[model samples]
Target: MRESTTLLRSPSNLASSQRLLFNSKLILPSPVPFKPKHMPCKVFCSQTSESSSTQTLKLISTLRAIPDWADGIKERGMKKKKSLYNHEKWLQHRSSLRHVRHLLSSLSSRVILSLIPPVIFFTSVAAVVAAYNSAISMNWLPEFFPLLRASSLPYQLTAPALALLLVFRTEASFARFEEGRKAWMKVVSGAEEFARQVMANVDGSSNVALKKALLQYIMAFPVALKCHVIYGSDIRNDLKDLLKQDDLSIILSSKHHPRCMIEFISQSIRLLLLEESKRTALESKISCFHEGIGICEQLMGIPIPLSYTRLTSRFLVLWHLTLPIILWDDCNWIVVPATFISAASLFCIEEVGVLIEEPFPMLALDELCNLVHDSIQEAIAMEHLIHDQLLTKRKNHSNEHLTNGRPTS
Candidate 1:
């Protein structure tokens, strides 16, 4: 249900999410500008002969394999809840604590809301213990039960150990978070380089259609990778305008989505007319995409060791459960609120560490993928402009040579 309250519901969220929190909750991103998938096919048809009609027919036959539009809407509704905010927004209020309004909003945040249940359970335990002490002091009962009290010595000795456990737990999770971010950064930059190499090196004049389709494949890699890391992602809608029906179906059915996109890229590269060396150089760029994919898969498949995580959780819960007893001798009835504050603060830190253990959702992957798509599409439009200017200037030079029978200076 939290997915229902995603960024797409509010127009104002568009600016902040464009890059600030490129991390998205929805399987589908907010709408970006795009050309229809069939536009490139139509343009290529005008320039080529009848034999190309065979590829067009194949594309038409695959159209029936696509699911209905209504089915897509229902599937998107099923993705598990994505991380609501990245670490940046988590500490946004630390700088300005002068206003009471900021304090109220902080308390209402999803992070605090999640901690309420555990914090309440600990506080109630403290209240019951305090009541029992009150009854014994009033002589309402005999000294039959031992006092729920602990000395300061054991706590003093274990304090350093508890501090180290929490520090190590948080540090490890943050390292994974940083690694995921860097991995995505590599993927985004790699996609950009591949597109740049393709547009500049490949001569689109002879086979403009293949050139257009290859760029589509390059753009689809990051989107496919985004889906690969984030579970419950269906590429059919995300890639509708970038791939043909047949290619889309192949990727959707494949177990490894990003690998499928790379195969498409490699096949397109082979069909293009280019020097062997240039093709090799472009293939090298495609290889970098696979490296990024491997890093992402490693992060998702292998988490921080389970035993360490379990130890940390068990330690935090036990520490809070016994906290009131240690503080009762010094503060008596004040132990109830002390227990509340301790549980809320310590548990909040550990919860954050746990949330970021898997880094994709905390990273803004959808937004980065969108950036890859826009950059390639913009380059395609610019490439056509440059080609037209070069053609016009060449025609002028030809006319001068024919009229004067001499080369123009």
Candidate 2:
């Protein structure tokens, strides 16, 4: 798998990099340094032996050959791909670190400040309690109320109720995550089926080039979607391979790349369905793509509401505070253990729920963008193989026509 790199450079720098075009490919270095006044660039250039001059000519001619309609498509596709690639890259890059050091560092000063008062108060209370206990033992008053004690009836009931609520909420959040995964699977399956139908039923002889381009689009759309949802943009060369030059031009000119790509995919599907014989079947498959997009959008747009989150957090905090008080009366020594267990349980539930609520975002545990990229590449490769076969068949047909003295139009 090719690793993505982010480049931070000025427009002049970007122009310079584009001109370099070494070996008909760009070599992206790992941990590419970000210069002032530029964004980081993803590194995953091709490795070819062609000289920079040849690469420039090739790029120019390729751009010129792209249809006008394809003008902005490549840029849009690339933006979508890069966003997903970056997110997945970040997730993968951060997986080894058990803790987020940067986040911890930011909190260090505040944590120290918060600890002082609690430390002083607790120490003073302990000293006074010890003195009072000694006096009472020496027959000063009567007896000392045990500082640590177990819970009574109210706490027993409250603990079980809170536990059940936490468990239910966590399970519900997990169910949403599972649904999001299933939806993506449906997208992949539907896209594959639609591509197969087009390849099998469409007339290969009429506009073979256009048909091949459409097939590439079919392969690229889902990959673009995966990138869009996960990383917020596309940063892969795979997009450049699939998008037409005209479309690429338009995407570069536009601001909303993902939405544009979605529009392009919808338009392509519409055009494919305009064919006489396969119209109905193609329409059905297009509907599947639409449905899949809707499902993913639902997952992305509707998260566990903030109201519920606030309520849960408030309840947990209040529950914890009262917990020590309740237990201090009966289970003095055991209060420590009980408090620790309760806090751990509440924190775990909150953490798990938060992770599942946004299934599209790449996490340390996410199925990285590389998975989607690989699947898309597989689809494109299959399309390429089919195109090659079709070309071979055409060549053989032409040969047979010439041998039989027929005109080869």
Off by over 4 Å in 1: 1-102, 390-409
* lDDT tens readout by residue for model 1, 26-74: 5557675567767888778875756568678777756533333323432
TM-score of each: 0.73, 0.54
Score candidate 1 by TM-score against the native.
Answer: 0.73
> Which residue runs does candidate 2 get wrong by more than 4 Å?
1-151, 231-238, 244-246, 252-259, 269-274, 362-409
Residues 194-281 of candidate 2 have per-residue lDDT tens digits of 7677667766666476567666666666656665566444435546766778877775566655456656655665565346557677
State the RMSD for candidate 1: 31.6
Q: Rate the local accuracy (lDDT) of all candidates.
A: 0.81, 0.60
